[model samples]
Target: MRFRRLRAIALKELLQIWRDPRSLMIALLMPFTQMFLLGYGVTLDLKHIPVCTFDREASQNSQSLLKHFEASSYFAIARNVRTYPELISAIDRSDCKIAIVVPPDFSERLNDTGTSSVQAILDATDDNTANIAYGYAVAIVSGYSNDVALDALGRQGGELQQIQPVAVQSRVWFNEDLDSRNFIIPGLVAVIMALVGAQLTSLTISREWERGTMELLVSTPVTPSEVMVGKLAPYLALGWIDASFCLIIATLWFGVPFRGTLFTLFATTTLFLTVVLGIGYLLSVLIRSQIGASQVALLLTMLPTTLLSGYVFPIDQMPTIIQDITYLVYSRYYVTIIKAIFLKGAGIAALAVPILFLLVYAAAVMTLAARAFRKRLD
Candidate 1:
């Protein structure tokens, strides 16, 4: 039977893959290891941000305000300085991320004028962290001020019973907790897939050439299409298995929500693997050298997936030329699709453009890889 021959070739390739310990590691262990390291290591949540304070007044009110900053889980008061110069030294030495300067008249001014001012100096070397810390400080200060106002009003004939102003309530959609991991883990799937799929196949056909097995394979009854399919089958199955492991780790271990259907996830992953594997096969056939194929695969697949796929950075903020170039990166489309499925619970209709692009890319690359493979055999 035709199926029997194809199965035999697939099993042979699988055996070859199994005999190579490094390939087994890459196929089985690499994805989960990368996911674990990246998931736990990469984070945007700012916590325990060190701060130094200079309380010139050293009054009850100023102390009360300082206590709030120290109480917050977001901030930690590293040291209390006596002078502005000491505060500056802490920031300059990277001992603190923020510096609080409570004016000498802080308590007196608040008691007399019902208001007081405090200055916060931030180290902006890490601008994103600085901005987030600043926001946290503002929110704490605002809540303390509101408490002070309420206390004052309560003492004054219970003015709190009078008409209250409108209050604004904020609601966050999708990632309701605003967890950075929720956004990051989904995009990482694309990057890991690119690295694993491309690197694995990048050496496959090249290894055949290097081992001088191409001549033997060429003389077989297997057609080029059959050969390509048989070669791709085991790796494709491995890719899916790796993807499943990633999904499990992301959702259960990392606690990232999976909002889309399993069918959609599997479908998109299949299309993406097709694109990357085709690219790897094409490079392997053309170069006929494992080292060259690997370098080219890393350059084309891994680098682009990491940088241009909008995985770690925002594509919109990039230059127009760079953004235009990203359109050609298949990982870009897959990243969008994965993120939407993970975060937005997007259905097929919602992600038609990206799906279409992935389809076109897979078709084009597979066709080209087939041609290159046949020519190389001849």
Candidate 2:
């Protein structure tokens, strides 16, 4: 008999969700759309770059270097300046991201001592862009030096002692190829689960309250736990379907690797959904109106989950207090687990901490939601 009522309620919720095309569209498209926008938008690739040159020397070597900068695909010489003041003024006016100063003794020093230094001033307004520009400038200068010294090296190569420099090799561990899709799809899965589980469940339950169904529900023989589970079961299924779609799309279309056990991933994701759905249920009980519950759920879940969960922004770089706060957010552990399982092939032992956190989050949120429901019904 209880199974019949549970099925009826779940069926009604699914029907309502099906009728709402907006919610259906969001469930389908939001994750992929975010992946496309944020992945392409946050790239490290450099294209046409604005640069200014202050060549006071105007010598053959300086002219040769300037020609190389002009010819390179990475840089466009936006302005030529004879004085430091003009270069500073151009940078201040946002004419160029980088300024190169060639000293008066550039060619003379190179001819006499075989070594010369150039000054590159980078605008620090956008640190990442500035860092890339700085590397490009350094590469251009190093190429110039290499080209000029090739002839000298060729002449003295026979029986000459060579200078060896210390070299550092860097390797990325989890993402060997640095495929942004691997990181992004997992993060999007976390964000999408948060939105669906929290926003939808909260709004649906709040709608029930506004429609005076909660009074009828509490007056029935159904237990609070059963009612709460019944209310969340449909959304939980929806969240699972959304997650499956994301995992398949990312793996098949984008070629994102899934290295860990699929069962482990699903288990962790289920815990995450429970925490998010519980929060939604708690929000619904606290706020009597659908709009208020929806707003509160969105505010509590969406922004922080996306921003502070190390989805796009690395948590290591965030403020310490904010990092401390992320511990309480279910999505934080979800992002960690998904990224680890997908990218790092991390097993249960490797993911124990995040798994524990997710379980604890689910338990806490579920307890709170049950209490909220009891209070509201009484």
Top lDDT model: 1
lDDT for residue 351 in candidate 2, whole number 0-100:
92
Native-referenced Cα lDDT, model 2: 0.82
After superposing candidate 1 on the true structure, give the runs of residues whose Cα lies further than 4 Å from its correct spot: 1-5, 162-168, 375-378
Name the runs in model 2 displaced over 4 angstroms.
Answer: 44-48, 54-93, 143-151, 159-162, 176-185, 248-258, 375-378
* 28-86 per-residue lDDT for model 2 (tens digits): 67767755666556544566789999998998889999888999888999999988888
Candidate 1 per-residue lDDT, tens place, 259-324, comes to 999899999999999999888888988899999998999999999998999987889999999999
Backbone clash pairs for candidate 1 read none
Model 1 Cα shift for residue 13 (angstroms): 1.1
Model 2 deviation from native, Cα RMSD in Å: 3.3
